[model samples]
Target: MKKVIAIYPGSFDPPTNGHLDLIERGSKIFDELIVAILRNPDKNPLFSLGERRAMLEALTADFKNVRVDVFDGLTVDYAARVKAGAVLRGIRALSDYEYELQMAMMNRKLQPDLETVFMMPAEQYSYLSSRLVREVAKLGGSIQDLVPEMVERRLREKLDPAIKLQDARKMKPGKRA
Candidate 1:
């Protein structure tokens, strides 16, 4: 089998179970699966860069061919640097496909050689997303089913009742950006 290195890039805000599934599957197709945790400067992530990387490393600790790292810049730029065979993307639904398709095309334009391979995960995690997981957890709801045990605990730590209450106290009402 010809060895190929694939880069799976994402913010991995907390690296949900869905993300784990993608990495696990990506490992089988590519000789090396690099889980590049993106440091998106635009959004205020609930977790810090180091915290996000730690979560990802913990989640994919068992896969022999799966490695975790962080990248700050355009994903296509990083993919080119690592000579990635193709950018690995997970498609959950039609909406997701539409967005990912746009991104893949743009990446292709940026670098003609770089391609994107879309992987559809198993049905169990087809609807799972970090956004919904965070919303549920932040509202004091159980997230045991949405993520791994360690990730559940970590999510709770960041969205603990005490911490949430403290944040609410710090919020300024009727403030416009």
Candidate 2:
């Protein structure tokens, strides 16, 4: 029997509980699940590629069938290179469904043999997203429930320095307030 390998590609700046939920579910569905992180140079990311990979690796360590990897360029191309038979995606809302549908169609056009599988995270994490997690962390809001403990710590470490720098700039040179 041929092993079914699935690639789940995303920027994953800071992988959230929603992402973990998908990974857990996908791991059970596929023989192997590769959590591929896209290295996009155009957009500035909250966490470095290494940091993101590290967090995903740690978060998914318990899933023997799941692995974390980094990739650049087109996701379909990477999926082809890895011999992945399907691409796994998560849809949390109507907006996501629309976009994912378009991408899935385009990917089919590019690689007719590859399939796209869409899954929804648990209802509790239906509204969760990495962007929202980053926004909350950046504004000094609590994110304990949105992400794992390790990710929360890393987010704080990555954002605290910037927050301190911004606060330092706001203070007058000689004034101690």
Top TM-score hit: 2
Candidate 2 local lDDT, 64-170, one digit each (tens) = 99999999998889998999999999999898988999999999999999999999999999999889988877876677788999998897788987556546655
Error of 1 at 168 (Å): 20
Per-prediction TM-score to the true structure, in the order listed? 0.88, 0.89
lDDT for residue 34 in candidate 1, whole number 0-100: 94
| Model 1 pairs whose backbones collide | none
Tens-digit lDDT track of model 1 for 1-177:
767889998888777778888998899889899999888889788888898888788778899988888888888889878878788999998889889989999988888888899998888889988888888778756666668888887886877895465456547577431
For candidate 1, the clash count comes to: 0
Error of 2 at 174 (Å): 34
